[model samples]
Target: MPLEIAIAGGGVGGMAAAIALQNQGHNVTIFEQARAFGRIGADVNLTPNAVHALDGLGIGDRLRATAARPEFRISRTWDSGEETSRLPMSAAAEVKYGAPQLTIHRADLLAALESALLPDTLHFGARVAGVSQTEDGVTLTFADGSTGDYDLVIGADGIHSAIRHALYGADDPQFTGLVSYRGVFVRGEAPDLPNLDSFTKWWGPTSDLQIVTFPLNRGEEVFVFATTGQKDWTEEGWTLSGDIDELRDIYKDFHPEARALLDACTEVTRSALHVRAPMPRWSEGRVVLLGDAAHPMVPFMAQGACMASEDAVVLGCALEGVEAEGLPAALERFAESRIPRTTRVQEGSLANDWLKKGGNADWVYGYDAWGALKYEVV
Candidate 1:
């Protein structure tokens, strides 16, 4: 039997879920609050775990073609500019995890995901105002005041998710005491910039900041992330303007190349980083939560998107071979299957915050999301 599923938020997580469910022969309708799906962020590190999930979607090769497989990931000190340790991700990662880690532009990745979806299935500007469920199905009300019912409702909305608030109550998200400043620069233009082919981070004591750079859109764009402390991080969208002078002042003592990287950044944005405790439940009746709606963790481990991709795959799997009575059972199984693992990633991401960022993190870097998926399913 096919499911009439309504998904809120067409982000990477939501889009991945829509693709998964649709591939499984279910009807998936995605509602995005944005007018279009071009997110204004720098590069995203998709670990082997995430790549494996992409492989399942048959876009792994395409993503690989559009991404750079970094040879190494290293950490350095902001002041001394000393290399504390290094993890050769490109060298040994595939042997260990069965997939290579990739760093790509958020826009390119989102476009890849959107290209996989069926035509017009994604409805932009359809901000989900509320969701309610009965014995038969779930009803979704949009910000435009239009309402529709479906056999299932998936809350793929992000951090500050309206769906999460409606289903789980309005407890504010916890501030992880960290702020993120991000930007993108051109490789050819920034001639003095450090070689960003490999992912790197520089850690400082007390107030912490990091810079990550990678190629996207066939080396046409380079995504950069500069994270620091922001006392006034607000709920603004990704396009919020941030000052490059502030970033340069903050990282003045960092490596020369690192400083050059920050100085060269032309497009920068700032946001407060918020984390969450694992929800008590991910589903209620026919309305269920997915992605950040269910588990919005710190970006320390960069597993947020990976976890959402895993959720889509698992949710579709659980829905297989199920009857009406089994809908609840399948959802329960999906929640049970996802909670513990996502919890580990969540905890790991939080832990990474305190751990010296520049220190080599092979343990965190070497994860097999696809392998874990198999372990969880079997």
Candidate 2:
């Protein structure tokens, strides 16, 4: 019999897991709490690692078509308006990692993933409130008071995963002590800007601002993201509406180019970034966790979705032969293979975040996710 899998969460991670599992000829169902699922941010950078993961899913070209390949990564000093470092993206990234980093609208990526799902497989508005696993199978109880059973259960529901709470316990997500404000702008609206085809980040002491500018919809729309550390802001929800004036005041000291970009941003979204401390274990019995549910990190590294995609593939591969015996050992193997790497990434993202805030760019853009996968993993 094919493995019957119930996936909790319909975000990027969940959808990616579903695609991977379905490709392997298994039955997968995704339970999402939200009425709909799509990304709100203007644009997000998919490092080489994420591109590789997306390639594994056969969607890399589609993603690339809608993305802007930044020529380099540009960093500037917030107070002095001086270029700190300009790292080449195309040559260095391809020669070093075997893949090029990309930037695209979150919605475009989600739509691409969603278009691949089988009809009626994704159940929206079905929030999983609890999950219980026994020796034979796992049972899921949703917020709507419905119940379902599956041979395997995956908690890809994200940082505040309710399935994780059932497996472990309720705990607060660690506050990263930063707040982010994001919005998109039109290229035609902003004039005389360099149009550098590069990601720009401004650094300051105890706070930092970063912006992602990429062309979307065949160069028709420009997407942007601006984030700052707010000592007083505390909200974990990523989609919470943010104030534009606050963002304007926050970036008041940036260079004219950066300031013009910020000035063009209107109706920005805000959210408090949260970090999760590593858990000693990510699986218990037949139930296991994937993506942000297993390891949620600060967006500093932008590996959150990439790591989740990795988990889905690894978990499905590790559990390839469980039907003949059971899933305990497979689940254990998944944790062992994933935990160390993800933990390192978690710490690395946090460290990079701190460095970006302090204007340290020497090591940030030099990562090779494909090489890391080749050398680090056997």
Candidate 3:
């Protein structure tokens, strides 16, 4: 059944979803709120599970080739630089999980996803003004007053999803009382930068105060993730200019290795952490929410992108057996199958109470989205 589908974002998750749906022989369109398609800021880790998901789409190997696979993920003390946790990564990870753990520039990941999508598949400057669903199908209205009709609509628009707000009401994101600064610098910028071939973390006395780094873009660059406790950060927007001095002061007691990385980074980006509570229902009528739009999580576990990537792949599995007339049931089944998994990720990522980044996550890493589960409307 070739159903018409529209995804409400052109980001990694949305693009991934668009491509997966397109592969299923469906008519899919990606509507982006931004004026164009591009990526800015942040480095991302595509662990074994996510790598497997992307591999299902046939682009994973090519994308992984552009990224660096660090040999070890070493967790250390912020002040003393003493090792706290050591885990195998890189080829070792591939041998264990069937896919290599990759640290990549966000741009590289985005490029891979975009390249697979046809040029005409995306519509930029198209903010979703409203979504309307009848018993027959769904339609989306953009801010500019144009309307597009589809048999199904997916809200992949991220945490502040207009489609999610329309389906569930205004559930504003609650700040997690934490702030983070992320930066990506060339390896040469910090000649003394430590552990370029290792996924490293300098854990402060408290969980909120930590600094993590890994190589990206074939070891030509390094990405740093630093966080500290901030009881209230009411600012709006995804990122802002971050002061390296302020970051230096936050971890003043950190090891000299961490300080050297900070001094080497001239610019940084800041964002106040925020997450949404679990939704009682992720779909209504013919519309459904996916990824951060449905279950936003903090970055403590770094599973945000991974979860979204999974959503894109699983949606295809959920829909392949259904016809357009059964789209609602397919969506319901999609939510049913995904909610628990994503809930585990949402709660687990909070302060890393359950799983730490780069730790042993065979259960999380071993999922095969295309082969997971299949559903059909009776």
Candidate 4:
């Protein structure tokens, strides 16, 4: 039977889940706290694993049309400008993993997922305040003092998820002692910058300090992701206005090419990095968690969003054609299939040793979410 589902937080994970579930004939709706979607976030890397899942959701062509296909992933020393590693990407990744790797503006990626969802499926300014599950249904209380009932509730509300907190007790995220500065600029603005054609990173003296640059929107723009050690951060949000001069000062010793990229930026945002240990379980009764709500990790491996994409597809498969009475078991199955893989990714990301010197990434990029759930008995 097609179940009535409610997704809290209409982010990439929530929208992707709505698309996948709607494709399976379920009735779904997304309640987002924001009034409207804006051109927020810098750039996101959709490695083959995430691309394959989006392909199954029927938006592969839409994304590929606008996303930059980097030919290589290059790494260099912080100050010497000497190349340390180069990994083949673009066509090579597609040939090896069955899907092309893409670097796109985060807004564009969200637009692609939003375009696939049905009309009247999204409600804005509906912040989830609390969630309670009955024997057969779940009720969601919004910030406006309104309430709604559904057969199942998915908490895609990010790391500080209200749903997860309502289900389990408070679990504060520990700061990773790293602060990131992100910015995006037109490619033409940095005409003389070296290595703009590839995804490049200049390694700092320590693992926690580095600057990564990649092209987005068919190579028309470049995005910068720079991180450095910080002792304390009291900010409560992710996209606070960053001080460009302070950013440049932190990376003052970097190679001229890297400094050039930062010099080209007109604006930037800063955020402190934080992570939580993986939960013992993701689902409680009829309400389940997804994305950062279930397993928030450092962004070292660039798998944060990809793991959410994978979770969406697997959750859709786990619930297809299931009756109300069996929903809990289906959700349990979804968690079982996803926890081990996401947990491994969470731990790996914390270590921050991915592809620093051109190591094998097959284990991370070669996963097929659709294939993994194809043979499972629901």
Q: What C-alpha lDDT values do all the predictions have?
A: 0.76, 0.73, 0.83, 0.90
Writing each residue's lDDT as its tens digit, candidate 1 over 1-378 gives: 888889999888888888887887888899998888555664678877777777788778778778878766666677677777566676478887667888877887888898899998999888999988788888899888999989988889988888888887897888877778888777776765554666666766544567656655555666677788656655756667888897888888777877877777775887777888987688887777889889998777778887888787777767766655557767877888788888888987887653344453444454444444356553
Residues 178-229 of candidate 2: C-alpha lDDT, one tens digit per residue: 7777777666777567754666666654445665455455555556666776
RMSD of each: 2.6, 3.3, 2.1, 1.4
Of candidates 4 and 2, the better by TM-score: 4
lDDT of 3 by residue, 328-365 (tens): 88888888888888898888888464323235667787
Q: What TM-score would each prediction reach against the true structure?
A: 0.90, 0.88, 0.94, 0.97
Q: 188 in model 3: Cα distance from truth in Å?
A: 2.3
| TM-score, cand. 1 | 0.90
Ranked by lDDT, top first: 4, 3, 1, 2
lDDT of 2 at 336: 83
Q: In angstroms, give how far residue 280 of model 4 lies from its true place.
A: 1.4
Model 4 local distance difference test score: 0.90
Clashing pairs in 1: 49-369, 75-358
Model 3 CA lDDT for position 110: 80
> Model 4: per-residue lDDT, tens digit, 1-378?
789999999988999999999998899999999999888765798889999999999999899989999888888989898888898888998999988779998888988999999999998989999999889799999998999999999999999999999999898999999989999889999798777878888888888779998888899989899998889989877689999999899889888898998999998998999999988899988899999989998877888889999999999988878888998999999998999999999999899767777788888899999877778775
Clash-forming residue pairs, model 2: none
Name model 1 segments beyond 4 Å from true.
190-195, 353-378
